[model samples]
Target: MKPMKTSYFPIIALSAVIVVIIMAGLLLSDAALVVDFASKKQAPSLSHPFGTDAYGRDVLLRTLSGLSKSLLLGIAASVVSGILALVMGIIAGTAPKWVDNAINFIIDAIMSIPHLVLLILISFCLGKGLFGVVMGIICTHWTSLARVIRGEVLQLKEQQYIKIAQKLGQSPWTIAKTHLLPHIFPQFIVGIVLLFPHAILHESAITFLGFGLPPESPTIGIMLAESMDYVLSKLWWLFLPGVCLVAVVIVFDRLGKQLKARFDYDNMRG
Candidate 1:
């Protein structure tokens, strides 16, 4: 018999850390809002591992709160984007030539724009809040995944089983439901997982640029934006939130890679 795989350990550990961060953020969210003028601008100490911001709020708690919000936003945006990609991909894969051409042209148009610029414009047009940021991410981030899914579907259309399904006189919708979706499910999962980091980073960047969440919001982007003024003042702790954001992004990136590898291995074995 083969020895037990040890590769799952990293995945488990990384997932646990992310869960804890999200949970801690939810729990500390209310507490993070409590400001103490007397404690403002304090450096890192035992009581405040990340120190106090100029507003006298606990940096660590606030960071956690922001991270949680970001994670949730990322989840929401990525899932929506993934679903959108799935729909467009199916249409492109099964539709008439003119329809597929239209879809490809639209995808190309969206992809040609600088991602961040498109995100900013969408968010701004949507009125620059939670809804705006989420819509922006969903619209901008779906293009790449949609293209991937479209390619997968196109390839699947050539497979013997799919050809047989077509010969069976199955409708495009039926074939998509019965054949395409199951085959592409793994890719969808992987795409969504990989999209999380991009969603989170874009949200933060949009917020930082004042096109996303409001300044009063407890988000990493807001935290970093607020820290900018104090950067020259040697308030090193102010940057802690930015560091945490980077760590969280890295964790998500690693988790996506691990999941992709696991899925690829499973596919190969199958």
Candidate 2:
């Protein structure tokens, strides 16, 4: 058997940087302080980088705070969805044919809808704000993850080692917990990372539509919304936060693709 490639150092480094940024945003309460009323809408400079929002709040600090909230919400929602996918996938893959069919049917039904539209409808119905956005994301984002887990479990369950485990009198739970979960964990990790960009985008979209984070919040969407009034006059500072949001989304997307490629290569070699 081919040895698994544990060379995910690049992903580790990138993930670490992201974690640090998130932690800094969370741990630093000073980020909420407004240093200058006169510097409102100021351009990037040594004194007031990222300018100031309409309320004279430090735009940089507010952006970081919003980022902290976005990341926290994304992680919580993604984890719950991932766990649901893992459990449902395992059951559908390992259980009798009828069970598999039922789960598969449900997953298909969910996927048939346009994901973003469904998220919007759910968020709207659940009432506007972060809580609604979280629920909307978790509800719609699990389908693809579930399918991936189901596919992996189906393949792993039929392998010789799994059969050997069963023949050696290993309990089903033990085999799943020890053998199956371990092998599939790398894919699971990648899946979680992959979900982040989507989560960020969805959260931003909900907010942009005035149904996400509160108006006073400095979310990327809120920043953009607030900037609309000054677009004709303060062009550079007005759109700066939206540019940063695009950058963040692109960074995660590139990272996820790279990690997925590395894992796919490892899987093929194995």
Candidate 3:
């Protein structure tokens, strides 16, 4: 097939994302309320695309709802983590000597711990609910992005124009606002977009391990975990949510890579 026009790429990407979100949303309302023991464990068919789970709930609807839930949580976690990364990066890159050292030390301290263990500890401490998962993800996910931005800003700070601005008595804040931020914004956007998949995967992992959301929650992790029982029983529905989760993750990962390329310094200059 012929390639699409460059101008249409974002439109296509945005439409795919919207279609996924909209379908997930539309299926959410019906998924949570329907349960018929008579249809329990049905195979995939025309009337039930994903069939029914062992509980007789429509697997397709549940998968869609779980996907929507996970995506929303991932978005929230990524945004919070991204903002934390921005603040930490800015401080470490541009702050006074002592402040920079302090922030760097804190980052190192956190990085010393195993990430999943840290997430579990934090989530467990926060009581393992929606808030716990969000907070845990936000706290743990910022270090790498912060480090990237810190390096970018450190390089920017040494530029001849930055020195000129300092010599001309421009305040640090003023120089940062006018020069540093614009240079790093692209990097920042790329980091945030990339963070989404990690957030989603980590959220699911922690929830599956029982350190995030509760069993009562309608999340992708719960569906996958619960579906494990039927996997060996020749039940096609067991893998339905797992497949959907993989597809969603792949889509977001592709979107993130595309965003990164679009904002890439070399690509933009070209």
Candidate 4:
């Protein structure tokens, strides 16, 4: 089987830009570059790449701050969800029938709820904050990966390698450690990249709806929500950040899809 060629230069480029934006946001917070009322709602110029918000805050800085939080939250949610899913799926897949059934049922019930609503409920229940948002997004987003991991494990357990190990008197733990886990690690990593967009979108939506991040947290959704009031007048800066948020989300989604196709095709060929 030939390994499929995959180019991640675009992802790397986008990620670099994101990192630069984060650094700028962190640095500018200590010393404001036009964040007072005088710069509020000013149009884009050589000085301000993204214009200014209602408070005259540099729109670029605010957007970058929001982007930083969004990226961090997205990654946190993806990692938490992916790890939980992998652990749960492996246990259920390798264990007895009752455990598997229970896991499957719970996953199905959770997935049946609309994602936005689930995020909001979780966020609200946990109390609004960055940590709450991360937990909320992770709680709701792992069902799909759980299912995928469960299927993969079930299939893998029946494979010749696994059976050979079992026949050789290898303990279940050893078989799983030596064979199943390594084989699934790549799929798990790829699944995580794919999970980022969903986690990001849900995080934004929850924050926009006032259930995720705090009002002053500079999250992309909060920025958009704050911008909407003055969108018609005096506050173009508030809305501009939303556009940047959309662009970043789109970039992650596109990159994830590309990587998924590349990796999945390679897996199939192998």
Winning candidate number (lDDT): 1
Clashing pairs in 1: none
lDDT by candidate, in order shown: 0.90, 0.80, 0.82, 0.80
Report lDDT (Cα) of residue 127, candidate 3.
Answer: 94
lDDT digits (tens) for residues 59-169 of candidate 2 = 777777767777778788888788878888888888889999999999998899998788988888998687789999988888888888989998998899999999999
> What is the per-residue lDDT of model 3 for residues 116-151, given as tens digits with 9 covering 90 to 100?
999999999999899999999999999999999999
Better of 1 and 2 by lDDT: 1
Worst 10 residues of 3 by lDDT: 2-11
TM-score for all models, in order of appearance: 0.94, 0.87, 0.90, 0.91
Q: Please identify which of the two predictions, 2 or 3, would achieve the higher TM-score against the true structure.
A: 3
How displaced is residue 157 in candidate 2, in Å?
2.7
Ranked candidates (TM-score, high to low): 1, 4, 3, 2
Residue pair clashes in candidate 4:
40-56
Q: What value does the lDDT take at residue 240 in candidate 3?
A: 73
Candidate 4, residue 174: how far the Cα is off, in Å: 2.1
TM for candidate 3 is 0.90
Clashing pairs in 2: none
